[model samples]
Target chain A: MTALPDTTGKKLGLVIDLDTCVGCQACATSCKEWNTQGYSAPMTDRDPRGSDPDGPWLNRIHGYEIEPESGHDSRVVHFPRSCLHCETPACVTVCPTGASYKRAEDGIVLINPDTCIGCKLCSWACPYGAREYDVDHGVMKKCTLCVDRIYNENLEPEDRQPACVKACPTGARHFGDLGDPGSAVSQLVLERGGFDLLPEMGYKPTNKYLPPRTKRNTPQAGIEALPKGDGSAMDRLFKLADRLLSGAGN
Target chain B: MNPAYSVIFFTTASGAGYGLLALLGLTGARMGHAPSLLFAILTLIIALGLITAGLLSSTLHLGRPERAWRALSQWRTSWLSREGVAAIVTYPFALAFGLVWSGLVAIPDAVAPLGILTAILALTTVFTTGKIYATLTTIRAWNQPLTVPIYLFFALASGGALHWAISTILGMEPGTVPPVAGFALLMLAMLKLRYWGLIDNAPRDRTMANATGLGEHVRQWEVPHTSTNFVQREMGFVVARRHAQRLRKIFFLLLLLAGGLEGAATSVPAFAVPAALILLIAAWLERWLFFAEGEHVVTLFYGNPNA
Candidate 1:
């Protein structure tokens, strides 16, 4: 263990602006471009030109559509996921080889690839599944939050930010030293009501997400006061089948 | 969750090895094969080789390899640690048994007869490995009591098929293994049927809200980011129900035919060996699907939870 002081008092994290996020995959693409060339086996892809092609990428966006069964516009939300660099990383604790560890200074979860045996037990123990198996190195991989870029003294001080933060065309991501409460990222979180993803998992993810904006037209009386819609063909079919199954067929 | 092939191979290959070791125990091969001691030693070597390779493969997935020993410290609480310990303990006994089989050492001719005891000990290793997965309470799919027995049976069937195939290729003397392979395959079929039944009767109740804990009836309205993260890459995979159903059918037929071939191979060695090889491949796929299809309860939070 490097035994970096409990920078817990000063080690900062990210706060994602979900409301402003446009579901664009710029961050993912930039992350892949940076990490692949900069670290490990490029999170290698097999048969990139072939039909069964897949590659290891540290970031991805998921699209979700939430619509009322009654009448409402679907709320589409896009979530980008990475390692979170949690304050309490389960992945680090469960790692047998000390290959996985948390930097006490910044609370960044890192895997020392040299000792990684690739047992993948850490993956199972993780609810977030933050670790990816790097086939080329025969070791596990994860997002380092552009560790190479963030702290590189060779780079211009202005360039000392994560690749995803730099590439984000939308101002949805903030990178900063979370240790400073007055930092723009921290203030944004406090003002925006940012919440942790899956707080119940107890990993204490360093990244936070601004909650979805509540719609104004939604009624309060459960299903009764909600606007109605004509049943879709499948919905109509299911309703009839449900009636029959409930023994009210006649 | 990234389905590291190495770990998969380790668990699966070792499972078959342990299963074969178990079969060697159960069939009354309790004593030395004397003249065939070389064959026994070769077989044990192959078995141990596969097991060690598997262990090696699992470590390859770790971000830090040097800290692998820390896993052993958790045997009291972790099934993974127990697996490590169980695997190590079986070796000394196995080496001694090998010596007894080769007539290099005398068994005092009294204590639990080396043959049966060796067989039982080998099977114990397999049982322990299977239990490693079955004992995890956090992953509902793996936590089932049935998982241990199923893994044991499948391991035997898989190893038996592989053993028969290899033997024929090498043109070894036709030992009384085909029938045993057949028996193992039959048991595997029954085990698979039971496993499918168990899952059906208790399909997971994972919900978006329950998983994410954002609300009582949570649904994925949006993902907050645009990049693939740990959760999605590992737990996000899904096999179409229709495709899974088809695979299950194919799996059943493959095992059934392989069993039949093993039984008939006693009279027709040619057919049995090829069928056994095919059976081995099918079992590997079965094992792969078993892990792939299993849903982690944590998926409820990220959405696209398991069935």
Candidate 2:
């Protein structure tokens, strides 16, 4: 049913670390690779080789420049975005058909390919834009949290996890039962002070994002350590040249 | 928020249809003398035709139109499903009322009760339609108390205008329809102006920083994709403020013209049809603006400073 359950037996979700993500597309590509052929087959790249290739992808990584209010130096942060599988997901409840639903046992939201009419209401209901419209199949697709491989007895036990989590070279993506406070993922969240995205929206997202940590030795500190040059004409000229060159961006 | 033509057409057409049905049901039993068979047939045909055509047009944008029937199964939670169910239920009430009013069934006592029931169902269907957009919290512009009231007011105004034109065209006395329609048009104009003001001044707190859970001064350095994706195309649609201002002016001007013409029609019947047409055009512009101005929260991740 589209109506959400009162509670789930286990909140199986991912915890993404924004500090370690390198803006690499490994998680996104790996998610596409596994999901396209596994459950929700043929993720449908409308024009793969064309100048403007477009397709449905379950995960995407974005880059941002953060200039903190405090004296923390400005830095670039890479963020990986995906479905949070909220406890009270509007995407599931807004589905006119009973296609979009959250699993009562594990709390992972999934859309039934056979029943989705592709009205795109679920996509509209999502604040994170996690729902992807499959143009070829005329249905909605999204991150299933690797439900197929996560429980497959055929695969090696170590390989049983979400493709995105398994493929993260930096170990930025952690997956486990979030409902249990003693779980490793939950402990990581507690230690890092992991926070929910758009918390004011009040969906109570299951997944959490660990914010980037501040650098101990900032560029300003390093600049202060440099020796003060003797107040010579050539020194002033060199300083002017250095200032002009610094304004140019890569 | 992309303002798909199919949905715009569906809502406007069906909204007006339901409004007309409700009004007809309210006034049907009071008409002491039964109108000619031709008039009755024509009115019912126009109302039902607009409704059926609208319902069909709604499916045009669906990915799997064959599975559209499944939409009616989740009314327990979904406003869209409730709308479907209410719309289907209205059909039977409408048909029964149509038969009695047209003298085809000749059950005089059944007319009043059936008419009341039909009117209630028709209004409920329109209410459900309004809730579909109002309940969606992702789009800040649409998730408001005023949204549903605007929808209801537009329906009554447009439907009232249509009724005036039909009555005048069929040689029936226009009676209080002209004034009632004029009043509805004036009220709609006021409500719409207030709605615009509310949306413009509403606090937009959903920023890129909060949306991504990054620090307060976050700025998007790079998009996730080279080309625009479905989310951008669907929810990131933005309308220039200058163009929207011009359109708002055009909307009010059209509304004024419709109201003046509707008022004039009471004396000179020639103005009635033109008045209705002008009101419909105005309503369509309003509907288009409704979708175009909507700001979805997802757009914040795509570098929209605020939603």
Candidate 3:
């Protein structure tokens, strides 16, 4: 049972926009809140109010400063990471108990808590660090893509997406069937040049991240300016010229 | 790659146990011919005890130890399951070999075959254990061609050291086995040093930029959570360079001393127990370093991008 399905009809995954994400933790928090009481309830927080608080979380955000290159300017990118529901997820195949499995219908990777021994090998197998060991329930937890909400017929169609996608304030997160080439998410990825994280590792992650767009013709602004009438007219003109040259260079 | 003590002990102790078991399987027939009942019983007890204790210690790391039995069911894909099944299968052969050697049964020709079977099973179990880590592409430090050989050689070295100690105590002539043990010890030390060198020198194949797929030169500015989380605790363990260097020196020195003492003990005889004990301690330290030094690629997402 641990052997991954040869293929799935639909690969439900996420497409995140790095250019739009504001580095806010809304997606992560909403994911935590929904999953804490959903598929894997009580995602226990160890010493929540104490000095060294820690717990299991399916989604995590990381902020990175990409230094300036020869032509590109420096920028800050916030990366939200979770299980990509990989095509060849080692985490599923490495499970000794067959508790970790991928759905044949949708390609959604999940863990059956009732059978998991919580050996923590799946977490090690995952290159993205998507799986987390739930010390409280003694099971492995991961992103289900809000399986509970996605399939609940009672919920509104528009509200049935993943909690993180629904809660993204800047519309940075998107979810849909990636298996269909004509899907909205797939079209977005195609138009935006979406890429996989750690493509060289060869997990074949389903999720994609659209890179930040290059900054264009915006005038450089600086705090330091020429003092008004503080020197001779020639000196003031020279200072103004220097400032203009610096701004243009920037 | 947190070096959990329970796992370190499990691998170290189990490797040594399996190594000893394999050696005993190769030599049990000759010893049975000697009909040294005491030696047979004591060695089997020691070997089986180490194996049992190591296996039991491994369960301590499991979240539900009672469900450990379920782990053996998925051998078709899981190396851990294969290891479990192999270990379990070897027990009967080991028990038969022990019983025959101890003169509890008069199965004359069965001893050698059973011993060979046990040896094969032991090696298979050890190989599966090594594969468990070697197959993990996530941790670059562990995913390498050298990992399996390193595991195999260390197990042999430790087993050889223990075999020498037991043979010496049993009044056997210090034969070529001592020199073989010495050679294995040297190989283990060299392989471990080479592994360390390779990991240290290897380029950061999974950089933060590649991990995020954003751009090159991406450096972590902030972590997602304010508090430490499971990924940080499990895969974010970091060892300082100074301490790692010191431990490496100690491990090499201890292994060298063990090998030298064991080789010399063949003539002197008095240094055998000390040599085996030192080798055991060295193996433990080496296993500890093995876990502590492994930097999972996922750590790139946290702040230590240039591993």
Candidate 4:
């Protein structure tokens, strides 16, 4: 089996286009299904057969209704939160057992389950809450960025993608080498002004987010003077004339 | 910062055991208690053992056992590291104290050379335990200015209780146990009351809007993700305000019964021995809730209600 080019010596990451994301939750559902059975440790939901249920899951999406400007209609931006695979992951440095570490090769933060003690200290250290305790196995787990799948060469090159990226029906999630400026993900980021979450925390997140953009054409200046459809024909005509004048800054 | 029941008991119980011993070693020079030497030695060991066991149990949760030494190197930045260092340094001093104790010998005019070691070690142990809590900036409950003082008080209270209990068990008269036990209980009560007040007045840092970091007047209509993730499970733990109030009441009752037992006791030995143990458990419960009730600063980011 031909191995994909070494992601080593490069920082691999995701560029999530928030503008296009529909918040269908397809990515989250697909992730749970794939990682649960496919990955070594599935998210254990305690009390699944009853109420007061709690368990460990790797990726969680936080929904926010953001009204950035005052007196504006709110928009729900589906924030699919996961480990950003930071350049300097707080979780990595805080791990006492060296179980949690940022791969020197790819910059993807990963947990070496053998070394983890499940102290959950690494979880507390992380501001993103990316780490979860696998109660069944007694270890911390997180998004591997599909390190297992992305590099696997057994499947077609196009088929190799992170489960979340694969399952994103809206095509909001992109995976590639962020280091290369010419890469599709990188170019998209550069063009759209993708940003990192909680930038001030200074983890230097590898993942980037494309900001939400407004819809429709640029309205002419003073376009608000134009009257909406009304019953008074003469009044509407006069308002149109006024709008034309205001459009020219008269 | 769950403040696992075991750890809560371990730290407070162990701190008191060791802390009182350190005190006994320091004042052994002036006091005429026969077991001053014996108690001090036993306590130093007990404290060291408590700390060792706590450290060991904490490590049991780690994925990598062999790499434990790497943790100590990060003391400059990590509280866990600082805690480890302080504990290790204190252990040797504590051990040296027990070893060099000459108070056990017939020549008891002046105190042993180890008294100084003990005083330093006791202070160190108390600070280390407190630092462990104070370092957690995420848990608003623990990440307070009061964590250190509360820890110090517990150590004293537990030590007082342990001293009271041990002295009573050993048939030490009122000359030692009552005053220390009384002082310990009072100090412990004061700290608990102050902590209760601190939490009551603990101002909320974020509203729903500020937490989402979108605007000042924001409300979460829907969560972005379909499945639950780590942040929600870990940082988003919010205890109901009513439960917190109920907890406060229980804290008050326990404090009254446990911390106030010494003054109500008819006999120092008879009352102190049992009462101190009861209060230790109460102090422990208080510590656990202090952790569980603590709201992490990060919880605000997700629009979770502040506890």
Best by DockQ: 2
lDDT (10s digit) by residue, model 3, range A169-198:
999999999999999999999999999988
**Candidate 3 residue runs with Cα over 4 Å from true position:** A69-73, A221-250, B30-35, B174-176
Could you tell me which 10 consecutive residues in candidate 1 chain A have the lowest summed lDDT? A1-10
Error of 1 at A78 (Å): 3.4
Indicate the residue-level lDDT of A26 in model 3: 92
Ranking by TM-score: 2, 3, 4, 1
lDDT of each: 0.67, 0.88, 0.86, 0.67
In model 1, the Cα lDDT at residue A64 comes to 56
lDDT of 2 at B278: 93
Error of 2 at A218 (Å): 3.4
**B9-80 per-residue lDDT for model 2 (tens digits):** 988888888877877777776662246677678777888888888899998789999999999999999999
Q: In angstroms, how far off is B149's CA in candidate 3?
A: 1.8
Provide the TM-score for each candidate, comma-separated. 0.65, 0.93, 0.92, 0.73
- Fnat for each predicted structure, in order: 0.30, 0.87, 0.84, 0.33
- The per-residue C-alpha lDDT of model 2 at residue B272 equals 89
- lDDT string, candidate 1, B170-254, tens digits: 6674466666767767777887788878866785665554433334434666554334444556666656668778989988888
The 10-residue segment with the lowest total lDDT in model 4 chain B: B206-215
Which sections of candidate 2 miss by over 4 Å?
A: A68-72, A220-250, B32-34
Instruction: Give me the TM-scores of chain B across the candidates.
Output: 0.86, 0.97, 0.95, 0.83
